[model samples]
Target: MEHRVVLVTGGSSGIGKSIGIYLKSKGFKVYGTTRRLDSHPNFTDFELLELDVRNPESIGFAIARLMEREGRLDVLINNAGIGITGPIEETPHSEILKAFDTNFNGPIHMSKAVLPHMRRQEKGLIINITSIAGYMGLPYRGFYSASKGALELVTEALRMEVKGFGVNITNLAPGDFATNIASGRYHAPILSDSPYKEPYGNTLKMMNEHVDSGKDPMLVAQMVFKIINTKNPKVHYKVGEFMQKFSLFLKKILPDKVYEKLLMNHYKL
Candidate 1:
């Protein structure tokens, strides 16, 4: 059998790197993309291609390069994302658009680029690394949630649209994981005298603590490998701590007010 070819965006570090390396260890030909190939972190086994998910031409170029080398791309992981931390009202409109462009539009662009190639092969998988926040809005991370939420809906629709073509798409909504996501987060300017300062400060601190204690990125990589090997994979998967994963179930079953209150309590809003 030919070695399966896989492409992972934002593979320079953290979850993307782990996924790329893990898949390679499983005997797949893995290619990871970073915006700057010269500065990419060390990953001895897999190939690293320069790609900027926010740029359509870059995405196509990287994919074409991989196809030239491998002939056929078996899987594409839309794992590149950015986070903005701030109250919705305080965040600049431009910042919100930037976040959405990277988190939501980036995946859409990559999927669009890969779909035709996958269709020609009549077999392929696109795994989107969304966030658990995609299922529910987060306090300081409103736009982040919104972006992932939008992508989540797209995944559902794409799965239905591509099922006939032997193309599988799914969203992996992960909880906080130990990664470099925090380093790239955009902090909304919060004035000391602002009304939301205290709560926002507390919430931001708590969010970081939760992230600091998050599960290893390799755990998520393991899950992705499982999904790849499964003949029939689900459309949505939650990869995180038990309670965090269970919260989505609660959100569906609990009354609106009840769920809202629980969320407020969780964030100390």
Candidate 2:
């Protein structure tokens, strides 16, 4: 088989970095994008591209550069996103916009930019990195969940829309992965004083604790490779241990009230 050319956004660190490295190890020509190009840790074989997914021009420029050099893009991974922790009411509008721009719109723009090329070739794969929160709502993570949930829907729609063109779209919903995702390094809006301050505060604390104990990002990267290599991959792939099972089961058998109660108890709400 011919080696595939893969592009991963937010590849400077965490799951994106792991995927880029893993794909390179498997002999794929991998190009990784990062907002902070200078800060990206040096990876021997992968190409690093500076891309701000929120900017349409940036995404276009990056894709143009890649296509100019590589001639074709076989796989595009939309993994650049930010995590915000706050109650829906307390979260500022600007923060919500930022989340949507990065999480949802970014992927949409990237997909659009690459589609012409993919369609012309009549073969390609698009992998979207969403979250378990996309499948199950979490306390104090409403904004984040909403953003990811939107991406989930987009992925599903795109999958069917591109089927005739031989393009596959897969959504990867990972539970908690060990990464700097909760470190507030990406971007966030200022918190405001509100009536539900205590619950919001407590929720943020709980989120930090849970994220600190999350699974290795390498596991997620491995799953990405598996999905891409498969001749016919599933529309959705869930990673992680407990969260994965819980999300799947809750969506299938649990009642809304029961699921809500379990979530509240888990988060000490």
Q: For model 2, how does the per-residue alpha-carbon lDDT over 1-269 read when each residue is reduced to its tens digit?
A: 77899999998778898899998898899999987777756655478998999888998998999999989999999998898876677567887888898999999999999999999999999999998888867777887888899899878888999899999999998888778888753323335656667767777777777678888888988999999888877888889877565666876788889878888887777
Task: Indicate the residue-level lDDT of 78 in model 2.
Answer: 93
lDDT of 2: 0.85
Residue 241, candidate 2: alpha-carbon lDDT: 78
Model 1: per-residue Cα lDDT over 1-269, one tens digit each: 88999999988888999999899999999998889987856656578999999999998898888888889999999999998988877889999999999999999999999999999999999999999999988888889999999999989999999999999999998999999888888889776888889999999998878888999999999999999998978999989999999999999899989999999998888
Sum up the clashes in candidate 2: 0
Per-prediction TM-score to the true structure, in the order listed: 0.97, 0.93
User: For model 1, what is the C-alpha lDDT against the true structure?
Assistant: 0.91
- For candidate 2, give the lDDT of residue 133: 85
Q: Which stretches of candidate 2 lie over 4 Å from their true place?
A: 41-45, 185-193
**RMSD for each model, in Å, please?**
1.1, 2.1
Off by over 4 Å in 1: 41-45
Q: What C-alpha lDDT, on a 0 to 100 scale, does residue 262 get in candidate 2?
A: 81
